[model samples]
Target: MFDVPLMNRYGLLAAAMSVLLCATAGPARGEEISLQKAVEIAVQNNVELNAFRKEEGLREAAKTKAGLLPNPTLELSLESGALTGNSGENAFSVGVSQEFLLAGKREKRLALAQKELEVYRWQLADRERLLRLDAKARFYQVLLAVRKLKLAEGGIELNRHLYQVAKERLAAGDIPELELNLVQVELARSEGAKTAALEAVLSSRAELSLLLGGSEVDPALPTGPLEAGGAVKEAQGDLFRLALERRPDLKALRAEAEKGSAELSLAQAEGVPNLTAGLGLKRDTTTVEVAGLEGKDTSYTVGITLSMPIPLFDKNQSGVREASVRRDTAGSRLAVAVKRVEREVATAYASLSNAEQLLSLYLRNVMPQLEENLKLTSEAYQLGEVPVLTVFEEQKKYLEVNQGYLEALNQRQQALFKLEAAAATELTGGVH
Candidate 1:
């Protein structure tokens, strides 16, 4: 017979708490990372995010190009009359001209380019926001997997202990062979469960590693509590307000609309034709035949010329219309984005509330009693007051309840992440 102290020593709740507290060290020997470290790594090294960041440089170069002036054109010409037997008669001309932008087109083009750069900057900010959210979610996934693996390990040990107790009872003739066989079956099932849990741990860690831009061959280990996280206490209205003020994508759309307006201004300015003004010096050499000899006479002239398109054929009407339409479309999209963000905040707020309530129920009521239930059942079976099947049922129930509790924790943590993402701000302890 087993001692009651032995029955109480490894109670389910105590084992679960110990596992939750101490099992955060990852299975592998890789570097252990907290949630903050994971997100920082992802932002710094994620290939796609870094690629998106390069677009800012492109936009900056475009802005620089937009602000530059058009280059001047140099013209030269020379003529000889040698083919007509007048080799001494020749002319040479040199000219320089510059095409000047009309109607402030250069300024407008530069404005549009500047607006485009602003839009891209806001978009990059939004991309970073989304990357942070994704990294947090993946970290939570790894935490959930690790917790499950630990729980599964504890289940294996509990089953092994029960199996040994059953063997002792069987040898002393207190229990039948079938009881020992049943305990053996439970032990095998626990081992199989552990295998599955370990697989889940590996898979989740691999995903996190990829997100962090780490090598899959040596994935980083996530170290955090699955149950520990923050929740928002703000009302849905307040959260939606914060989202409107903070969402970078919304700001990007606003900047895009402004850029469209600048585009329209530039298109209108483009309808005005540029003027090319030139200054030239011409030299002419001729032989005079009336002076009884071949005396040479030279003449020099200076002239100015101006030219410009008439704008009678095309006036950039299509370009103007296109820009107007683009502006309107951006405005419409911004309106739609506002509505979408509101919806997202509402949905996330509701989800977080539900998950919090469910987790609270588990923590306050269900999880508190499981240890006593398992301990009492095990002691009763050891004293021969209950059958072996009763102990098995209690143990099975303990595993199921803990699994449910772990799921609750994961759901709650995910709900918090979604809410923070929707609002585009951190909501720790109900404060932004």
Candidate 2:
């Protein structure tokens, strides 16, 4: 059915072959990239996508088989030799036989193949969407990890200064040794926290590397802010309808159901026996005595043969039943997928809104006041109006609050990805 020109066909083949070979067209190693760039790299270089691109080649092969006719068979025969001779004559025959598919079986097979091709296309698209969404989430996770590490490192610096204050207060006999010792213990905890944060950075970076389809991925951080996405605008639309229209996984399930129906039709068509027929040339030779003289006689004949199976035993009943069951199963799965998408949309919408509200509240009313409180508490401790432990507690609270803001931002972005996955389409002007 394709009307592609020869040059276009070659171009398509080359593109598919490049995907099959996992040829990358991404930024070079050690280059900093945005989340969109990371997803693009993954789509272009992932071996999993390469595997999916090969499915088309397999489907094309099946299509070729389905559209083909049976080959003609040649046969030769010799009969009535001297060993079993009754008339002292030999006969030789040459024949060609052809089997004809009955009940439009070839047409049914082609329909099934076409349906399978449709299903494969949907599946590949679904996989690509899934990979891109996952890459976005993992990319943000790495950013979150880096933000946390920085928070932890800054905590150590803050705690170190507090420890110095406590030490000076101890030397002046304004604080007990026990107070200085407590502050020293908190300083050690912050040190351990920094080390833990460093470890977390390594692991999360590795995971992002894996998502980018390489172990040698750059350690450089992604170039985009975690707070740039998640508008919750899709929630205002008819989300369920949008998911039905756009989700590739849902479309794939629908195509699978169609494929199942086609397969059932193919199975029904396979029940009837095919017609086999042969056409041949035959020859006979004999020697006879006429008027006391030996004479030779030769006869040539044309013969035809035709046959078909009786279908007395198995007539593809098992095949039809299996196909019917599978088709029903596919329909049930499609229904389930639809409902799952609905839940996903609802949940992601709620999460994105919650994250937005949390970040807004933190910025407007919570974070500013908290920072002011931390500054006041530190000054009070330096003036000996508050205990060293109070300053230590305030510093911890400050670190946690800032970390919470970054977490909210990351969560909102991740929620955007989840919504995209649910809709099976990225929000327009939201993310790449």
Candidate 3:
């Protein structure tokens, strides 16, 4: 049965609660920066990426230079000088010559330039991926610091309470003054821990700020479980093959080898020699009789000349040899990169697996036991059956376990990040 009056009351209560939450959450949400926002800021303002952009512009200019035609050489001369005492016999000449490329040098250079550009494109993407990984790692560090500070503050409060209880108990002769003094000393220690944790939080924030272009981040931490990240995918077959296809550094090396091949070919092409041809105008003056008429005559003569250097002494064998050796070196380096990627993938997988198991054990077994023990010990202390110091001792153990759990989770995340770097792929979209 639908109760109209009860339904109305429940609807009003839900609406009021929604309004209250919004009212309280508005300012905090405004000041808080999300992980996605942090990544965006870092990527957009990254110094290395900006420098790469400038270098890209320079490479494009080089491509343009590679495609340009050779400029012509201009020439001028005086055939007869006045010192010969033949003023009217003076002859002047003007000529232009151009050397035309005989082999596929320009095309090969352009192709190599394009490949180099492709390499830079992929390198830029790889760089961004690394930058985003760094930002996410620092974000996680900040969250860890925030959690530690909370633990320290709580420890201080609990120890201060114990100190108070000890004072009362000592006044009534229920316990010795030594216990009270010990409790006081413990409270001081907690305060020291709290101070160190606070300093750590500040230092973490400063580091993150540097990554984020010096913008100060709010203290309100990211709102999510640290373990909430992408799972490691199953590697079915040929992960190395995938790395070869995707790894940008490897691609850059391959591009260098291709460029070296082109360079070697260019050196051989230079050995083929370019044809240089010249066209010129020569002035000639003579007095002669053409058939039956005699008159003073002026004439212009057209002259053509062709020349090229013989490939006898320097046939570019040294240049070709140098380029071939460099190409071989690039290939060897690529092989080394392949070996490195394979090892990194295997090692990272092992670390991630170990971290996963330890985290599971802590959550499923150790954490609960520690929590139960701490709760019971605290209750016992309140009932005067146990010393307050005993409760603190249990808490100290609990704190260590929690800290270890956080560290394990951190290691798991690090391993995943390393896998991403090695594979040139994202394990997580990185929002976590």
Candidate 4:
């Protein structure tokens, strides 16, 4: 019989071991990394970004080849035949030939290749920007995990003190054994929560280390305290306009559209005929023996050859249609990209506004009231005016609210990051 619980237990154990291995494999040395350093490391080691850089180099090489003139061809021939009755003749010829692209064909090809190179170059830039955003997101995740672990540890310490006070009261018969049992159970729960939090921190650290392309990581990340006091002013419309102009992905799409236009031009140019011209020098030597008379003659000939393709069967008409279709597709894709960026920016702005409001409410109203309630409940329990259960409930409420507030703060910070990423702007409100 299949056993689901057994499988789940094994899966959990495997996951725990994986986390432990990642945590213990390599230790970070030197000072902790700032956000800038983290972003730099991700850019240098990210596999996708490096692949794009290599692709850009290949496109550049292709562009160079496209701009070069075609190589000339060499022709050689030898012949032996009868020049007269019972006489033999030999001829040898050599010529050099070159084909010239007609009607600015080479120029059009070069232009198309240049546009394609620009597209790849901008694509690489776009990949770098996305990689930086990924790194920043992972960095903040680790920071959040670390913060949560600290909160859990603080809760454990507070619970330990309360357990000790409960033990003293139970020894003096001021509190019943049931109250002491409740404190003990709460301490145990706190310990479990702390353990879970620590596991989360380690997991986040390992993820970040992998993103940095190395195993060594400092789990103790520094996060600046939240600053919510600044006035909440709406971002300018011009800022979003600048982001539309400067965002690398949008630029890459624009370049792609231009390359498609060039492709269309090249396809149209294919209808023009190319010319192949050659200059040739030939030598003919003949010996004639007519019943006792012999003569030798040699002659040189210069000739010009012109070759052009006939537009009878195929004049690349299909290529023109294909190119036109591709251009239209590129145009459509570009429009869709523009719309997506606009929606992304709007969504991020809305999230930031909501997060700011939530953080403010938690900081100014919710947390302070929870703290006061906890204090009052503690005093009442000491004076026997309230049951010990009331005090315990108040403390639990206080801890829950504290955790909620921390979550709200982290959410706001993440929202700010989203806004920056969407707008392609720095935190300083300038275009990145």
Best by TM-score: 1
| C-alpha TM-score for every candidate | 0.92, 0.86, 0.85, 0.87
Cα RMSDs of all predictions?
3.1, 15.3, 8.7, 10.0
**Could you tell me which residue pairs clash in candidate 3?**
none
Tens digits of per-residue lDDT for model 2, 298-365: 89999899999999998899999999999999999999988888888889888878888898998799
Per-residue lDDT for 224-248 in model 4, tens only? 3433334435564654786788888
Superior candidate under lDDT, 1 versus 2: 1
List model 3 lDDT by residue over 1-432, tens digit each: 122343443343344334322322221232377777887888888676777777998779888988987899999987654576554455778999988788887887787678768778767877877787798788777766766766666666666655655665676667778888888888898889889988987998888877876564555444444563766775813545566677777777787778778777777887787789999998865456678986656678889999998989988889889888988897898788778878877786777778888888987999778767866675565446887668768868866776677677767777777666667666554321
As for candidate 4, its clashing pairs are none
Ten residues in sequence with the least summed lDDT for candidate 3: 20-29
Q: By TM-score, how accurate is candidate 4?
A: 0.87
C-alpha lDDT values of all predictions:
0.82, 0.77, 0.71, 0.72
What would the per-residue lDDT of candidate 1 be over residues 1-432, giving only the tens digit for each residue?
Answer: 543355453464355445533433333344468777888889898999898888788999999999998999999999888989999999999999999999998899899999999999898889888898899998888877877787788777777767766776777788889999999998999899999999998998888888888663254577667774655668899988999998999999999999999999999998899999999999999988875778789999999999999999889999999999999999999999999999999988888899889989887888778867877777676667899888878878887888788787878888888888889888873322
Q: Per the 3 Å backbone cut-off, how many clashing residue pairs does candidate 2 have?
A: 0
Q: lDDT (0-100) at residue 195 of candidate 1?
A: 96
Q: At residue 124, what lDDT does model 3 achieve?
A: 80
